[model samples]
Target: MENRIQLSFTVDKSLLLREAISQYGISKKALTSIKFEGGQIIVNGEEKTVRHILEKGDIVTIVFPKEKKSEGLIAEEMCFPILFEDEHLLVISKKSGMSTIPSREHPNGTLANGIAGYLEKNSSVSTVHIVTRLDKDTSGIVCIAKHRHAHHLMSEMQKAGSIFRTYEAIVHGSVEQDSFLIDAPIGRKDTSIIERRIDPEGKQAKTSVEVIKRFTVNGENLTHVRLKLFTGRTHQIRVHMMSVGHPLIGDDLYGGSLAIMPRQALHAKQLKLVHPFTKQALTIEDEYPMDIAAVLEKATIDK
Candidate 1:
């Protein structure tokens, strides 16, 4: 419920809090939020402001107050895997087959439903607010805010590029290049209500991809790719990969053959962001599931 993080540094040279924060790679946004949030910056057992100068061997401790959870959401009893959880945010490790929130058909059995069940016991959280979403078949990290203020803060951070999201996938073919950028416009498909594709008039979308590994399986070529999302869009990864002629292995809707897995072979692997209230830099990673791990195992090294 309560968390404390201390970033201790030995001053090789004298410095102020600003210089030390820069040297230590601390979040400046976090330092500024101390006025609003219930946190303290302690230096050598004494509380001090950021303007205080530091000498050698100063131990700094940051105290993060436990956040107040809200109420009103009806909780569902599903045991969704939690990657990281605190008062401010909950990072969920979503399964490949689960939806983040409810649709007309999937009104229940969703991540939101599970979160509601979780908050029911805590008695502090109000409505469920999902900060990030994953496609039903794409498994990985999804962030949820405990309250509305946290939601607004995270959304602004995402627009400013402070909140970073990354994913990994097994695509249909070997990539000729080790790394490349897919800078394309994405728009909704005319035929499908949920499907998206490359369109000249659509909003700008960019995905930076790096090949982690490449191999052949049953004479079929596949590449393991890590992609960084610059802009979040519906079916961005699935659509972009298809445009490049290498859709995800099991993404049938996006020109991919469904032979290995039943769902798209994409994982939300990493998420990085600054804390909305505490100002800490946060990183969450989901463990590779056995389904994807099995694919990695069968892949023969492609030289």
Candidate 2:
């Protein structure tokens, strides 16, 4: 069933469009676009322009459109480690090898399918919205919104830099510096699938890396590192690490050839954001996956 939402609020005499933008944290362009689309924004029960002036006691109504569901959305049964859940959102520890959403060949066996099953079994949530997505091979913390409003607000927060994400990785070489920032541009390769390269014409990307431990595994140097990303781009960490000549272990696409591990040794270790409903700060962390942990343990043998 498609869900609907109606919002009612009284505008103050001194309220201006800019004031509303500041309060709502929505771009003027977005607001204007919504108004132009028709029936989205109403002032005193009538369709209004973005420049419409408001008087005291002017009742505003916002009617949001329902998100269209994709056809043939396959549902699958899979388990998600629930880190936290509430009326507004959910935090889960997504495992490696699970795609976040249904794509061409992987209609099932995805995190979205598992989440749908969970919501169906619980029966409390009417809709699920994914605010962030991790790579299929990268495991770690992910956030899901239970409602459209929550999704909108949380996504806005992320765009405004109110959300923070941290990751952990095991790179193939020893990192000499204690900490450093990699500010490189990334773009698609001229001819490649599942590959990205550092290019001058690419989008801006930055990653802060700090070495957590340095050791040897099977006579090969390995460095465990923590990464804090200032900008999120496709394959940002892997590309940046490779650009620095320290590609992550088991990362086949971006240059590391260590096959001891099954998947790329990257994990979304931490996430922080404010609650869309309660406005309280929420922080969550996920532990390292077993495969990566085992590799690290073997590296710690002091060989």
Q: Which segments of candidate 2 are over 4 A away from where they belong? A: 1-70
- Candidate 1 structure quality by residue, lDDT tens digits, 1-303: 243323455566668967776555445565555546776767888888878898878877655444444343335888878888877688989888888878676677888889887876667534687999998889989999875546666877888888899999999988989999999999998998989999999999999999999888888888999999999989999999999999999999998888988789999999998776567888889989889988888775323
Model 1 residue 128 distance off true place after TM-score fit, in angstroms: 0.6
Cα lDDT listed for each candidate: 0.81, 0.79
Let me know the TM-score candidate 1 reaches against the reference structure.
Answer: 0.76
What lDDT, from 0 to 1, does candidate 1 have?
A: 0.81
Tens digits of per-residue lDDT, candidate 2, 1-303, equal: 223344456666657644654465445554554555332767766776556767787877665454434356655566778998976688999988888898787678788888777866776434558988899999999999875666778878887888899999999888999999999999999898768899999999999999999998878888999999888899999999999999988888888875668679999999988776567888898988899889888877764
